[model samples]
Target: MKTKIILFLTTVLLSINITDRGSASSNYFEADVIIYGGTSAAVTAAVKVARTGQSVIMVSPDIHLGGLSSGGLGFTDTGNKEVIGGLSREFYQRVYEYYQQDETWQWQDRSEYGNRGQGTTALDEEFGTMWIFEPHIAEQVFEDFINDEGITVLRDEWLDRKDGVVTEDGRIVSFETLSGKRFKGKMFIDATYEGDLMAAAGVSYHVGRESNDTYDEEWNGVQTGVYHHNHFFPPDGPHIDPYVSPGDPSSGIIGGVSVAPPGEKGSGDHRVQAYCFRMCLSDHPDNKVPFPKPDNYEPSQYILLLRLFESGWHERNNFFTKYDEIPNRKTDTNNHGPVSTDYMGMNYDYPEASYERREQIIQEHEDYQKGMMYFLANDPRVPREIQNEVKRWGLAKDEFTDNGNWPHQLYIREARRMIGDFVMTEHEVLGNREVPKSIGMGSYTLDSHNVQRYITPEGYVQNEGDIGVSPDQPYEIAYGSLIPKKDEIQNLLVPVAMSASHIAFGSIRMEPVFMVLGHSAAAAAVLAIREGQAVQDVNYNDLRNDLEADGQVLEYSD
Candidate 1:
């Protein structure tokens, strides 16, 4: 294991192009634009900046690039394909090209696989954009992007948030990573899911749901009475006790249940939505990695699942409903029912926690997920019928090949949202208000995963904070949402954590949308540099013109 890691690290160090031009005095490199995060958005941002004839560097905390897109989220949540017309579409086009070759279909025959994608056509030979794919294929696409564009990428370089970001008069002068490498740039983009770079740059942000009244949005807060997706207990369904000892209040709360009262409906709290890995599982025996018991595995921790299964045994098939099979008989398994992958209420502190603590949380989630899969496959408590079905599937050994066949990134559905010059509210997303200075378009449904799992007042197990509000049509993503206020920061732009209320963010947080915004943010940054203007002061007219020329669908058809 150590040898594999060492060899992989050496290969990565050799493969990536980094400009460590100042090794003597804390290795520093200057660029016209600096991008943080190794997410798909980050890579696309670098590509856009580079194409515009500007020098750019991507300093990533992750060893792998393209974040969740390369990490196991092959089942993309792209809403309207026509609205996706920029670099985001270019990526899918590359996927399409890769799969057209006979070599790309190694695990399965092209004639055998036929899972037409969720939103856009997956293997569309006409459009030449394969929306769904394997994780390794996505990673390869991102690598190809950086290599083809000649964009420098510094992998595994974590930003030192505390003392590394040096700001002067609302502009980021330079930033240093924990490894003592420094980067100076005219513009910076935070494309990380965590919004770490934006927060470190003294950007004001929100981490949890705001009150419904705060934004006049119906799906903003507590949502005690509302259920959007089928991730909650049916109100009329039979009661499932949320305690280890049934109906005993004195007994401690169950593993997944919170003791606190779900606050008033539409009220605010500090709880964030649940996160999980968009796991890649395969039924092919030769390319399978059986679920392994994590080092910190505790059998008793999954007792709640036993109860859930016991209560809903008749719905056994429903448990496997979310196994969205991609090419090669591999599945992009996601959280479906109320008791699926999401570890509810366990990730509240992750947004602001230290890296070590965040890692611990991530490991705990990984263990819980893996252990649950193992339990279903072998536990006596689980029905033999379900066990037989689950046992047929295992990790896709061909994917995430380096990390024990585990996903390289966690599915961070929600995190810190920057409070920029314009906060995109539900009004704008739902097409009630006009979005001025359009930069990109978002059409995905407002889909938020469960935020908290708690015992209902009626003694039934319930998961709150799962919302799914569809937009009226594709809405424009405002340019102001990506940049800080004029008085706060002038050079930094945040595409991933752009200003939005919780409900609005739900629709805008899709991978394809992130890439679109990433492309837009870079275009704006390049224009700002050419004009010697702050990001906040970039001319919307000229910026819009450039974005349209670059194939960004900033507005839907009139």
Candidate 2:
């Protein structure tokens, strides 16, 4: 066992080349625009920069090209598809074109697939866009974009967050990666969900929820009793005890129940929302790999789930409610009920954690979610009906081929949001206040998953911070929200973790919107490069003209 462990460690060290000092042979790179993420936004931004006849380099931590969009979140959450435009819409159009050929349907016929999205057609012929797709197909589209533009992508290159950035009078000159390779650029865009580069560059940012008083919004802070969806304990069901021994105080709380007080209502805290992998599941016998038992699986950790089953969860049909269908008879399975995929209260430090620490957190989430599935499908304690239903699904064989058929990216719903020149609040998202300098539009309902699970005052298990609030209409996202304050950073733009209050971010953090902001951010970066100005100093008129000329939808009308 010791020999095997040492061999594995040595293999990993050599593969990463931790000892290499990054000699001049492959140490230095220069680009007109430097992107520091592998998200859908990063692809669009790179495409935009390349289309503008500028050199761009993508320094990505993950080997994958697209983030959640291609990471098992194939069922696109597009609210009002008409407002999605530019490279974002072009991406969907490419998906539409891919499915036009009969060869694209391998496991199921095209006619058998549902053409419905979030109240819209999944395959919108009129707009020439296809919303729902498979993980591999979305990734192929992003790769096609990169190949078409000749963008340089450095995959699996992590930024040295502690000492990577080299700033000169508020302008970033270069940033070093973990492998010691230095990349220099005239302008940079932090397109990561974690905002790693942005945070490393001394940019102002915020994590977790803010008090409702800070933003004067109804849905910005800790919410204890607000149940927007069916992700809560059923009110009519018998209360399940949170302790290991029912009606006993000394037995201690179960695995997921938080011991800390859930803060006063409407107050802020350091608790981040839950994180989970959006599992890509398949029911096809040839394409499915049965859920495997985790090495460190603990059945006692899921005792609450057993109690949930006893409290009528199966009769309520809650287990499989969020097993949303995608192409080829696959599923983009997300959190559904009181006890599901989400690893609540487990990712609060992820935003600012070290790379090694983040890896541990990711592995913990993977184990918990995968173990939950295994428990449900194989454990004798689970209801037979649920076990039978869960047994029908498994990991998709054709997806994430290199990563044990698991997703390459975790669904980081919210993370480090930059506190930039302009802060978007719910007032702007709900259309109560007019936003200036429109760069893009987001129409999705304000949504957030559960943050913490704890025993209620009545001694029953309950979840907190799940929110779903709809906006009156589609609203504009200001360009100022993407760039940092002029005094703080001169040439950096953050699109994925753009400036916004918590509730406002919930609406803007969608993949399509991230692509929209990425395209706009790249255009602004190019303008900044050409004009020899700070990102904040770029003229709004020129930025708007550039975006509109590229067919970006900046405004919506009824």
lDDT of candidate 1 over 454-539, digit per residue (tens):
77778888889988988878999999999988888899999998899998999999999999999999999999999999998888
**List of clashing residue pairs for candidate 2:** none
lDDT measured at residue 28 in model 2 versus the true structure, 0 to 100: 78
Which clashing pairs does model 1 show? none
Per-model CA lDDT versus the true structure:
0.88, 0.91
- Number of the top lDDT candidate: 2
Q: TM per model? A: 0.95, 0.95
How does residue 114 of candidate 2 score in lDDT?
A: 85
Measured on C-alpha atoms, candidate 1 has an lDDT of: 0.88
